[model samples]
Target: MPVDPDKARALAFPPVTVTVERGRLRMFAQVIGETDPVYVDPAAARAAGHPDLPVPPTFFFSLEMESPDPWSYLADLGVDLRRVLHGEQEFSYHAMVYAGDTVELRPRIIDVYTRKGGALEFLVKRTDIRRDDRLVAEATAVIVVRDPEVAS
Candidate 1:
């Protein structure tokens, strides 16, 4: 079955929130192979001008994944999950992500269009990492969803 361009165009998703913790920060640092003292040492972070351990740039992916499952959301639009492929991912960072921060992410469909080959879906996800209402960082992700047939 072909994807319902109209329904896919009208889809909306809910936002999700994630709280940064010391353990998570440590784990992320390990995964990214970061040997920076500021990532694991609070005292070092403070001395370095950060309130807490600073997470790596790619840590934003952890927060973005917390959003509602895109597969389930698309299924509601009559698109099969098995036919979807992650075409692209890009991130823009405004500031550093540090421990002891709470982040809220809102994922919205920015645009939807169909190509001669297949469907192309673009999503603009905004993440606000804050500390006591103070903006710590703003991250935007552009995700491209491609049809499986066209991907092959």
Candidate 2:
């Protein structure tokens, strides 16, 4: 099946809500080999002017996955998971996110296009992160899907 930019633009995904947790942040820091004290220790975070453990770089991507079905959007677009690759991702922050904060992620398919003579399709998704209805960050990701019949 071919990708349809119009269909992707018309779809609406439900917002996802997650409460940042200290333990999870610490674990993530460890898994990513982050040694920054503020991301793991509340005391250090407080000393650094944060109310609690601050989220590390790229942590919002993990939080966004907390949704019931993180990959459902791909299925809705008739994308074959096996043929897809994570093309790119980026995040911009307007404010810091700390553990204990409840954040909402609203994602939308902002753009879709084809490359390599239709052999490859790129889907761009932008997710806005809000804390108490205030914008805190934005995450953009590109998913590339390869045409099954196209020669690699």
Each prediction's Cα RMSD?
Answer: 3.4, 1.1
Model 2, C-alpha of 4: deviation from truth (Å)? 1.5
Tens digits of per-residue lDDT, candidate 1, 2-72, equal 55556654666665677778888888778778888888788988999998888776777776666657356
lDDT for model 2, please: 0.92
In the predicted model 2, the residue pairs found to clash are none
Clash number for every model? 0, 0
Estimate every model's Cα lDDT from 0 to 1. 0.65, 0.92
Candidate 2 error regions (>4 Å): none
Tens-place lDDT digits, model 2, residues 1-152: 77889999988999999999999999998988888898888999999999999887699999999999999988998988998999999999999999999999999999999888889999999999999999999999999999977665
Best by lDDT: 2
Off by over 4 Å in 1: 68-70, 80-82, 119-152
Q: Per-residue lDDT for 134 in model 2?
A: 97
Number of clashes in model 1?
0
lDDT over C-alpha atoms for residue 120 of model 2:
96
For each candidate in turn, the TM-score is 0.71, 0.95
